[model samples]
Target: MENPLTPDALLAGVRRTRLVAIVRGNDGPAAGRAALAAMEEGFQYVEIALTTPGALDAISEVRASAPVGCFVGAGTVLTKQDVDNVAAAGGQFIVTPSLAPSIEEAAGRGIPVLAGALTPSEAYEAMNRGAAAVKLFPASIGGPGYLKALRDPFPDIPFIAVGGVGLDEAAGYWGAGAIAVGLGGPLFGDAGSGGDLAPMRERARRFVALATQYDGRAAAESLR
Candidate 1:
């Protein structure tokens, strides 16, 4: 599963693991440390939010420090320039907060992207425009029920439930047919800002255990 060079391989791994750690912080070094900590506890994919101070530096630092198979990526990516910068920094993937030009830009560069999309129009558009997956942002608005409804129409599009996703909500997203759950504060807590890594690791362990129990996209479709 190292590198996950192709979209199918990358998203397949995501569907199986069912969790992605989103690291956002005020300090780059602190965020890097937190990302490494998450990887140590079984997180294969980690995204460092570009909103953090010196986020590219954090991605570079984590990408270098991480073990060979672990993939580090950049999130909140907004433009083609952001895509280029993250690729230069050794980020293996790009995650946008909305349907941005970066999706096609990243695709053209052979980089997979989790493009954020809210409404059904955006979701369909994101998929047709080369997004590796559609990120359901602020999923709490409609919760699992809304996701289930979306799946009914776009069963082929892989969905990554993001924004406001916590441990308790993780199972719901999985059952609703999300290929993965992208978590920020709930998973990182204050660790990215130099808070207790022990608690973060413990949370990671709990989330991983919970995620593995759900059958992800396949199970949801079968049940439908």
Candidate 2:
């Protein structure tokens, strides 16, 4: 396997991709397959949430086999131990559902974190603690209007809209000034649970096409 990219380099990759795929499943191998499939289809920044069974193993497996320039990371990370396990499994990045201690722990090890937050204070606090970007969790509640409002205060902070984000709502998120859009259920469907991947591939293709068409900058590295 290749050496992990530095936090800045990883962030650059994320910035260039403008999409993050969150994978969750009932089993390890299945989740790994789902991740690999997404990576193959241009979802380069893939996160296998720790909530999935045997996620660490999946991370280890995917890290060793992911496509070049694809990143395998652990998500829904809630504690320090989770961070340690992910790092040990060779996860190149870390993502949290909230402003958990794992964010600081991962940052301490030079691992980049997409710290999750909803409120303005929480988002600012996450960035203050060294997060490479802020993940606006449960972003559905307020929609693009809310994201736009948050950007007003933190004009320079990169915000990734997560939770309840789907294909239909993606353009709104982007227009609202999101640096990247985080996706899970709408993209994965039941693929991670041993469901058919053909449909998943189709969905991913549509997403990639939309992203590349919407932002040419993201296409430069994401489509290649």
Candidate 3:
């Protein structure tokens, strides 16, 4: 089924995909093709880095052609102008490597922002500034253990783990309480070199399975 759902619904379903594939392919054709591949693997959320050539146009075209439930967003956004551009392109969300007040302004207009942060303080500030969810960039350096430590202190805040994350790492992060995972090379996996997508799809499937298991466990624990 081609979803037939709204962007808001699509964004929510992104938690299910547990895979926000970041495509940094420099042109529209490659970016679009890569996005389609992710969607084919059951990934509903994909991010196009603004640093990529024609990134906004890629977002627009991808949004128009994406499956009904696909949630297309822009990454590497640093300013309110970038946020505006994302909204203008019909992007479902805005993700930044760092938090900016302009991102907050955009979030006020009903666009979701995944403001990136490294420390707990930055995460708190970003959330307070109206970020829909916080992105823990360079998570590879921090690792799942880092996310687990953060959960110890800030369980109330929502976080999306990014950077250096692989499909195989999904279950551990979910166990640590990540709301979603933002992946660049691993999920999108070498779009320029035309990397095979089979691994990516299998990874996505693993995430979906893990999330379902976690949901069930959470429910069971809640009833106890």
Top candidate on lDDT is: 2
TM per candidate comes to 0.93, 0.94, 0.83
lDDT of 3 at 64: 84
Clashing pairs in 2: none
Off by over 4 Å in 3: 1-11, 192-224
Model 1 spans > 4 angstroms off:
1-4, 215-224
Model 3 poorest 10 in a row by lDDT: 215-224
lDDT of 3: 0.73
Candidate 3 residue-wise lDDT, 1-224, digit = tens: 12233435544665565557788865666776787777766677888888888888888888888886677888888887887777788777778898776667766876777789989899999888878778898888878899999878898877788887765666567667787887777666667235666666665565545555665244323222
TM-score of 2: 0.94
Flag regions of model 2 displaced more than 4 Å: 1-3, 216-224
lDDT of 2 by residue, 1-224 (tens): 33476778877877777799999989888999999999999998999999999999999999999898888989998898998788889898889988899988888888889999999999999998889999999999999999999999999999999999888788788888898899899999998888999999988988888787885233322332
Model 1, global lDDT = 0.87
Per-model lDDT: 0.87, 0.88, 0.73
lDDT of 1 by residue, 1-224 (tens): 23455676678778779888999988888999999999999898899999999899999989888976678999999998998789888898889989899999998877888999999999999998899899999898899999999989899999999988887778788888888899899899988888989999998887877776565432322222
